[model samples]
Structures are given as structure tokens and as C-alpha cells.
Target: MASKLTMTPGEILREGELEKRSDSLFQLWKKKRGVLTDDSLRLFSGTSERAKELRFHSILKVDCVEHTRKYVYFTIVTTDFKEIDFRCTGESCWNASITLALIDYQNRRAVEGFRRHRFQRAASEAEEEPESPEQRALSP
Candidate 1:
């Protein structure tokens, strides 16, 4: 399988076979090897040379549609509102894995964004604020 698809970088949170619903008129369920990473979910089908990646930044949410005795059905909703359906064995817990990874990625991005904005605001404020008269005199 490694020869069929190149492995993506990052920690592998989980990896297993997943059934994905095709977008064709029949909407047939096809089995594919799924690799869950910190930053993306990579799906490899058949002998394809490349894996289709669903990056964390582009993902909006994961909706658990239903859970049967044998399988757990779920949907991955993207930022553009496209929903990709998938199902895995009940014990596989692919949905939970993907959801957790997505949440972690989003939280990290939010914190980084907040820090950048706060630093920029502080710098602007410091430049705009007037120095005290005594401090100004001491600066020569």
C-alpha cells in the first residue's frame, strides 16, 4: 500500500480502511484507505498514485449521521458547504479521530491569530501614545 500512495508528513493520528460514498448518480459506497493526520485527512482509492487530502483549515465540521451496530456513518462538511459522506467500522472511531484533530488544528490557528493581532495592536498603541514629559527629557 505504501508503494501505491506516498505517505504524507505529520503525525498519523489514525489509519484504516473507510467507505466513502461516491458523488455519482448511484452514490455507490467505495472502500478507500484513509490516513488521519494532524493537519489533514488523506484518502487513497484503488491504485491511484496520489491521495486526496482534506486539509483541516478547509474543513468546517464533522457531522455524525448515524451509528449502527456494525458501522458508524458520518459526514465531513467543508468550508464551501460540500459534505463528504463516510462510514467505518463501529470500533474504528474514525469520526472521533477526525473531529478531535480538526478541533485541535482550529484552536491552534485561533490562538496564533489572536497573538498576532494583539501584538500588532500593542505596537500601534505604543507608537500613538505620547511619552511623559520627564521621560522625554531624559531621552536627550
Candidate 2:
């Protein structure tokens, strides 16, 4: 039987170009190619070929700062409270895609936690319960 809990963590959800705001004094917007997977967002630099990966576990939330006729501005808040700014074409739904993927990843983690807790509780209960006569006979 197929398992509903099965999930591929590295599955690609979305891919596109984005404009990431730099940390320099001028805060120039630099173009980057983004690959959104089930567990992380990988941003590749256009000039340096370097990649910056932001895992879903570290991302706290995605905030939409503004929406203009030309672009959509958003911020990615990390677990440490650091914010990363980004913008993309008005028609490209990068922010929504990232938010949905992050939510899915978070939900998966929550389900796993519940499953683990339930399994542990069941095992403990079994250990504390008295064994049946048939079960005792089978034991070494």
C-alpha cells in the first residue's frame, strides 16, 4: 500500500529569477536564480555562480512589504530574526510559492512529531501493561 506520509524533501517546487537586495550601503538589487525545493530555497548568484541556501526549518515567515505595478517586494524573516529582502516581476508569484512550500515543510515536521510522540506513548503503555498468558508463554 502507498503511504500518505511519504514525502520527498528535495523535490523541486518552483524555479525562477529574483532580485535580492544587497546589504551594501546603497542596497542595490541584484538578480539571482532561485530554486524552491520541498525543504529549502536555493539562490544562485548571476555573476559569481555562488549559491545561498535557506532551509525551511530556519525560515520563520515571509512578509509581503509592497506591491507595485512593476514588482512585488517581500522579506524573508529567519529564526534568528534576520530579514532578507527580495523582489520579482509583478506577474511572478515567488513570494507565494515560497510561503506555500514553507508551510508544507512545517506541516510535515509537525505531523512527524505527533507520530513520534504517539509511538513512544504506545510503547511505554505496552511495557507497563501485564503480559497475557499466551504472550508470556512465547517470551524467552
Candidate 3:
């Protein structure tokens, strides 16, 4: 792995062997060593060559979970409908980690968004309503 790939900022969870599913004649499912972080997954063909990246926030869905006697396979679907496949040795935690990380990221975003919306709504409501005498006197 190159320093460039390792420099991505996030809580690095798993970094080892993961294979991308390829269907083309020239490309087949070949195993590659890459880095998986809380915010993104990055793969490289060579140490200095960047191949692909799947960022958690931009991901729209995760699908295609298939298990065999040897490995666990899954796909990370992006917002643009790009499906990137990944697999780890049998009974490994790679798939689970990816799913959980993405879910956690989404849940955090939802919480922040809801809080922001509520805060704005409260501010507007306060501006539209007159302060009661009790509140006014309590203020000063």
C-alpha cells in the first residue's frame, strides 16, 4: 500500500485482502490489499496507482450478499448506481464492518439534520409569537 492510500483520514477499521468483482473478459475478480476506514474504502492496483474508492456518505445502497464455502461477497452501491463488489475469507467480519460503518454514518447524519431542522423551526416560531408578560419580565 502507498502512503497516499494510507493517508486518507478516518478511523481505519480493516486493511488487508479484499477482491473487487469484475465481469469483463480482461478483468476478473482478483484479490487486492487495500484500506477500509469509517468514512471510505480505497483500493489500488499498485502501491502508487489508485483504482477505486467507495465513500460512505455518497453511497446509496449496499446489496448482493453471497456466501460460499470460501468467502463472503457483497457490493457497495453508490448514488450513481455503481456497484462495487468486495469479498473476504470465509466467516470474516469485512462485510459486517462495511455495513455497520455505513449505517452509523447515515444515522449520525440523520440526527444532525433533524436537530438542525428543529432548531430553525423553534427560532421561527419564537419570532412569530409575542413574549408573554411573565417571560418578558423574567428576561430583564
Candidate 4:
């Protein structure tokens, strides 16, 4: 059986904490599985007058839904306090070029924590195992 990957919102936010503001914002985009559209790019890149106008009140919205493939798909919504379709993708698509850049840093950290927990559990189990003389001989 495959183990489940679980994480919390606090953990997700913390991962992106060290990134530059723009990159962090981009990661938020990925976390939500948002595809960057022309408008979104303009705003995110600070390239347009409209972008400048709304920059102050702009916010990223992200939603993650559990999918049938045992992975979560994130939906990203961006707004100048108004809804905008910036970027979008489906759950099973593994296009890392786009996905990796958008991943919320906090989510990455949460994943790392989960990995560490699994590793520690395995190590503890190994330490708890009883060893026979033959097993000890083989351990070397």
C-alpha cells in the first residue's frame, strides 16, 4: 500500500517565506495550479498600467482538491480583489517547467516534513526489530 502525503496550511506558507516576494507569489500560483495568462503575467510581472493600478490590492487565491490519482490538484485564482483567470492546469499533468516554478514554498516544506517523518518511522522500526544470531551475522 502507498502512504498518504498530508500537510497543513501553516507548513505550506512557511516554505515560501524565504523566497523573494515575486517568486513567493509565483509559487502561490503553482500551488493553486494556476496557468499564467497574458493579463496575469502583466500584473505579476508589473508590466502594465492596469497592473500598477491594482498592484496594491492584488491577492492570490489557491484551492487544493484531492483527486482520484492520489495526488492533489491546486486551483489558483488571482484578483485585483476581482476574479481573474491567470493560469490553469489539471491534476495529472506533470509539466514541471510550469509547475515547479509555481509551487507554494510552504507546500514544499510540508512535503519535506512528511518525508522526514516517514524516514524516522522506518528507522525506529529497524531499531526495534529483534535480531537473531544469524540475523546479526548477516547484518555485517
Per-model TM values vs. the true structure: 0.87, 0.86, 0.77, 0.26
For candidate 2, report its TM-score: 0.86
Which prediction has more favorable lDDT, 1 or 3?
Answer: 1
The C-alpha stretches of model 3 lying farther than 4 A from their native spots are: 1-9, 49-51, 131-140
Worst 10 residues of 1 by lDDT: 1-10
How many clashes (backbone N, Cα, C below 3 Å) per candidate? Answer: 0, 0, 0, 14
Q: Estimate the lDDT of model 3.
A: 0.76
lDDT (C-alpha, whole model) for all candidates? 0.90, 0.90, 0.76, 0.37
Which of 2 and 3 is the better model by lDDT? Answer: 2
Compose the digit string of candidate 2's lDDT tens values, residues 5-29: 5746576778889999999999999
Error of 1 at 138 (Å): 8.0
Give the best candidate by TM-score.
Answer: 1
Tell me the spans in candidate 2 whose CA falls farther than 4 Å from its real position: 1-7, 47-49, 131-140
lDDT tens digits, residue span 1-140, model 3: 22334555576777777787776876578777677776777787656566577788889877758889898888888888877777888766677777777786787789999999999999999899998999899995
Which wins on TM-score, candidate 2 or candidate 4? 2
Worst 10 residues of 3 by lDDT: 1-10
Pairs with backbone N, CA or C atoms under 3 Å apart (clashes), candidate 3: none
Candidate 1 residue lDDT tens string, 3-50? 113545586877889999999999999999998887899999987869
